[model samples]
Target: MNFPRLQGMTEALRLTQAGQLNDATQLLQQLCQGQAATGPRDATVRPRRVIDLARALPKAIASGVVSPGPAAPRATVFNGTAARPANSPMPAGAAFHALTYSGPTGTRAYRLYVPASYRGAAVPLIVMLHGCTQSPEDFATGTGMNVLAEAEGCLVAYPAQPASANPQKCWNWFNANDQQRDQGEPAILAGLTRQIMRDYAVDARRVYVAGLSAGGAAAAILGAVYPDLYAAIGVHSGLACGAARDMPSAFAAMRQGGAAPSRAAAGQRTPPAIVFHADRDGTVHPRNGDQVLAQFGAGLGMKPERQDGQVPGGHRYTISRYRNGQGEPQLEHWLIQGGGHAWAGGHAPGSYTDPRGPDASREILRFFLQHRMA
Candidate 1:
């Protein structure tokens, strides 16, 4: 027996028992890699166990450690860099305020951006949700949505998900409780949106939501559960609503395409949707982009009009637009040929963003402004 290796495994188990999952996972990963490279290759070496441990790491942390219910709120400081360019100046009188909203569901922190152009007239409002391990400021800086919002004279709100809720600060889109209407994270998010509307002159007809990765998945759930509130939804590198009911399934859906979205309850309309996914994305399968569009375009009997384009010195992409009988576009899907698990055409200062792809922020806003509540 390799006593030193066995000792390392025992320590890893001890760390897991102590609830130091991050440290345990790291140690296991290192051990597995070293064992694979240097350990004896005899049949007695039990290679299958090592592989199983590696595979179970994410699932152990996701499903075993965290409960599906709402976690007690923890105060987290905003420490991420903003996506604003040094050369660009904030419009005079424009402000980004950090605020909190408390409702029947719970209390959550958020950041709102009010453009200088606002002068009491109702304007479009966009609710931006950040992905796992991301702060609102980091997401803002990465996607440059604030910059575009300023130019477009729109109010942008970013809801913060604290680490206390999930160690990774991820929205629990996979949790069944979080996927329902007027319940869990959905209710909190919707309440926050309503609060913003009441406090500001928001154009109810033009309200929209967009997100990346886990936030993208949450945005899909919000659109499905509250179609009346959101004119449209943009999901980038995300799964469809009801994609997974738990952590194991969420990981499965991210690896492979998720199962078909559950049918919406009677009287609920499927909100218009725009999706962006990179063909090369390993974190969330590219097929999920197709699934999101399909969920919204189902039963519409509309065929998509396809267009191919390339970014200047960057990636090649294909755009498919699904139009209604009256020629109104109800769904749009963008597939970046060589993109990964990052925001396409995003700024470098923020995490999980690709600067060379098509400008997803500008494109999503363009798609959003085209639709309003009917």
Candidate 2:
């Protein structure tokens, strides 16, 4: 650990011992942000690594300060109870299998949805990462991705983020370790995608990834770091890759807006991207949506073809489509007017959904199908 980080931690420990838990948490968050801004002095040191609050503080203090708050009730298959209605009834021959993938980083459980129409033929694969405090079933139900998969004969994978990794079960997109290729969560998720492709017949060029909130941010990072693995990405209410490097910065980015994305490297081809964000989002500032597209090169002097539409008896929205030099659509951004921080046009059974907006799932899948790896 860096000397300043160590000193800050010691100060936080003292504050915690003095029964100032909130102050300690704030201090720790500041320390995290400072570390991210300055980076490590040693090249070998990984900056913005995930902090283990439990090991750093008393159990009570860690429990209260580390997590945002008490998570909502989690939906578990073991209990045989439904937290929400199934996204849709499974068609005959369709299968939802729970599987696990272990890699050098760690092990994670994931759920795969195989559409009924899938035979031995190769089909497009979509990896869906759920938001914080959400389960695969809940996300599948909320986003209605599996139903779309069934209708379109696409394979969908939902990677589960356990509470052990994050108390809120959020992808650690803010951490430097988790943001890089072949490291932390990115490696696990990419490995999982490859494992699915190996286990089932999947179109190599048509593999895509999408997610909501923290998962959405993770999707952006994955697209940035592993463009060869994912042909396209869908980020709903997410920030740009490298938007923030720690908890304080994450919170700041969510509240206001994050720093501009770093320029893309030479010879790097960022995957085509589709982003969705509400103009009225309270939890995540809508500016983050623009940053997401900008990270994909949307801000590189390319003009977008803008369109506007409204859902029947629902929210109005604006779409800005950007094209590459060859006139190929490269980025699409959806801004839902009067929409909050939830999945647009999502089902009611799932958590954090706004049913009164355009169906994000349908649009995202359509966008994904339009592009593939060259």
Candidate 3:
């Protein structure tokens, strides 16, 4: 038994018993990494303990013994970040709601779903940022990410873009001002992450961010700005990097289109990335896919290596691994053919979603599990 982890666990237990739910949650997460790496016999002890602790947290908060953490930071309200408050209640395990720190522009709304398998111990967190015109609920329904999270014993968080910020509810990815590392929405989103850490037992090393369309662009920007925060990023049917500038440049760039400069030459702690774009994507265009793939390859300082053609889905999918100039991958690319501006292999909910072949959710999870912050 490693005493440090055991000590942390003891503190967590004491905090829980004392009704310090938020503190206890944070401590438990700190203890999880050490315990997760332990052998079977030792590992079993930690998770069981966490389950016992979770039952008491809600009670403590309800009894006024422990208050929820500070208000979530405000954000730039977009088309759907805000909705009639997630009052569309579902069963307990169906969904959980929690507000996080807001930014100067607007309030940040988030939804966390804990799988039945989650025992309150450290679990991977998947921050799914939604695209424009989409609310958290709509994204949840469209991506079917909840199903995958439940199967994998991971927690899912849907960070909403309040409609107040942008009528389209899209992440302001094209705004160059917002694209900087940890400035605008990125900073607010990081604050949301802190709130999540304070609220749940998240595995710090396994945190991941993924987005669709505008959301995808935001995810890319996130990995660049807060590379140390996210272990990996997933971009689906989105534009390349540098999509935003200021107000004027943003609209002009979006309308005229631009390429994400090759980040291959730069040296930063950029997290490994996974991009899912369809060659047939009409909205974002297939050329954007090439630019993104090339950017990753160059950023990693490695020549692009294409894989055997992907079949059966009407889309010829190609995966290229980028090894940094030092033979390390700072990025990765997944080009799906015949796929459109929708979640690949998604259900037939609408024309934009593809429900036939490889599951994008599964692939992204697999990719996340394979890498971690340097």
Candidate 4:
């Protein structure tokens, strides 16, 4: 009902303009709970809309800045000089670094997670992309990836999307510029992945990429364009690659639950993939999960291993695992009944997460480690 197109954000913007950051942050934390609880008063704060508010609020809180309007900072890159809550100090078993990358694609900032057990030995590396309005730290905190990586003796990298690019800090997965192998976001992300591989003792054969929402959509694109780079891909609550090539189509696809099913011919070159989505996902249709799985295991003509169960104390889910002729998993899809447009099994601090029974993060990692680049 508001011209802003996104409700609740208006009041938060007013608070931002008033210089009441702490109050604004608190309000945002409540308004943009990212798949958190909602009631009659929150009906205006739709799940998808809340994701935007949640994402935008964090950028505002961290940067000591705010856009002139509801969009976001105009220039991507790290906000001119915003001050975000420092990420928790890296633990003894692992180290974290905030680094910047400059290339033909321009400058992009990323956070690298290096485990303490590293002594110049090759280990798996995972490139994590954040959704709209999410920072590497927020994603890391919500996913608890570093803890998993530390125990698994692997490396995890978080690439941040500068708000200036999407205004909401969402990856331009629908932008033609960002879809090609040697082009846009694909090139930049690939370059950064390679750079990390070169800088660290990384096992190039075991490199992987995963993301949430827009970030998740981008991950699927990377897998398609650069199968050699990423051994496997994890797209949580995201659509398939090429689901949309523009904004309007992007929204349409989101509503329809992804573009038409993919008809990929299963083979060695086809990068294995795992997807997660919820039945009650208001932001993204549940069928999108089916489409993702279909695309991952397009051909090869293999039957799926299906199982349905509920989290011990959380939501119920259906898991369909597909494998190639060699019995190697090519695709696995998790359909969380009564889920929303959030990362299922994710914890707090990050937006758009539903802390339900089946943990998508752990499941993604488990599926990733099962396959490697040939």
Model 4, 88: alpha-carbon shift in Å? 8.3
The whole-model C-alpha lDDT of candidate 3 against the native structure comes to: 0.62
Question: Each prediction's Cα lDDT score?
Answer: 0.77, 0.79, 0.62, 0.71
Which regions of candidate 4 fall more than 4 Å away from where they truly are? Answer: 1-49, 52-90, 261-268
lDDT of 2 by residue, 63-152 (tens): 234322111222222112222234547899999999999999999999999999999799999999888778898899888888878889
RMSD of 3: 23.0
Ranking by lDDT: 2, 1, 4, 3
lDDT of 4 at 41: 40
**After superposition on all CA atoms, what RMSD does each candidate show versus the true structure?**
8.4, 9.9, 23.0, 10.3
TM-score of each: 0.81, 0.79, 0.68, 0.77
lDDT of 2: 0.79
Evaluation by lDDT, superior candidate among 2 and 3: 2
Single out the weakest 10-residue window by summed lDDT for candidate 2. Answer: 70-79
For residues 1-374, what per-residue lDDT tens digits would candidate 4 score against the true structure? Answer: 43332444555565554444334445556655553222234324322223432233333343222111111111111111221222355667667899988778866899998888888899999999888778998898877778778778899999988977767888888787887878888998999998888898998899999998788888988988888889999988777877777665665666565567555435537789999877766555566667776667644588888998876556778888888888777888888777666766666456556665367777888888888887
Q: Is candidate 1 or candidate 3 better by lDDT?
A: 1
Best by lDDT: 2
